[model samples]
Target: MIKTIIFDFGDVFLNLDKPATARELKKHEISNFSEAMLQKNREYEKGLMTSEEFVEEYCSSFPQLNSEVFTGSWNAILLDFPKHRLEFLKRLKREGKYTLILLSNTNDIHIDWVKENVEFFDEFKNCFDGFHLSQEINLRKPDAEIYEYVLAQHGVTPEETLFIDDTSENTKAAAELGIQVWNIDPAKEDVTDLFTIKKDLF
Candidate 1:
């Protein structure tokens, strides 16, 4: 009776180099992610801070790095979105078997990068019944409230929804709220194999 499938944008569908950002930062001698820096990121993800403010905060603190360099380093984690995944998603949508929703903890800059880099970004996005970006919704995963918001907004029962995310912490939170979850490992599995991988659920 799973009528809804909630997907995380990065890693789950679109490929992401999870450690690329840190690696890029290290090249610039910016290794430490202190508590304040993490807080700023959280605020940015929650849409509490504007992109200008977020970039400015980082650029100001690291005087050696300009906005462009810092932005590039920050966006290094985003990689290619496989065409097969988009095809899979489109097929799923065409089937009309379930409500497809996309939920991601993403910021303005990374989203901008995706739009510019991913040729079929909009087409892929059109498949989702509801597209909830953390920055737009002002809520993020692992925070319970965001899951509640999506469930409430869509009138979806947690038990009847499957959430796929590459992050364990995010899946754990959704599972706690009674949503079925696939905590996918990007290295080994691909979202395009949804039917074969989670056949039992289907």
Candidate 2:
């Protein structure tokens, strides 16, 4: 039985344009991210660097790019948080069947944008029994340590936990630890159909 439910924030609960940031940056003549930039981004997501320092690094690398423009392009990936999803989560919370936990790999700037844009962000957050953000925890997903951390922190057995994520890489990593996972495809599937889609689990 699935006693605990772990959900990924992006693409699962919130809508995201995965290619938006790259597409936006390309318009600024930043064709692709260099190895250094990718490393810096990983560091930034892990809370090794502050938002100011992250923007400064990019601005310094591309002298023509200012902090404001870079930050704008960086946040282009985030889109809307649909009302129905929040309603679904709220309904689940009210049932009090499983321990609902949110596990997301996100940075400070993106979350700040979410807080400003998503009106019901606080209410949505309150639905989770445990909310773990990558930047705040200094750990990002697809890394085994992060999955181990969540399981240990929640005191939940891997066999009894169901982790839902939009990325195959993340879901695969969690599955390796004996946790059941739904590698959801946002384009065709909606999270509100969780019970119907995985009826056997329930």
- The top-ranked prediction according to lDDT is 2
TM-score, prediction 1: 0.98
Flag regions of model 1 displaced more than 4 Å: none
Model 1: per-residue Cα lDDT over 51-76, one tens digit each: 99999999888888888998999999
lDDT of 2 at 65: 91
Evaluated with TM-score, which candidate comes out highest? 2
Q: Pairing residues by index, what is the TM-score of model 2?
A: 0.99
Report the C-alpha lDDT of model 2 over 44-124, residue by residue, as the tens digit: 999999999999999999887999899999999999998999999999999999999999999999999999999999999
Q: Rate the local accuracy (lDDT) of all candidates.
A: 0.93, 0.95
Name the lDDT value of residue 135 in candidate 1.
Answer: 98
lDDT of 2: 0.95
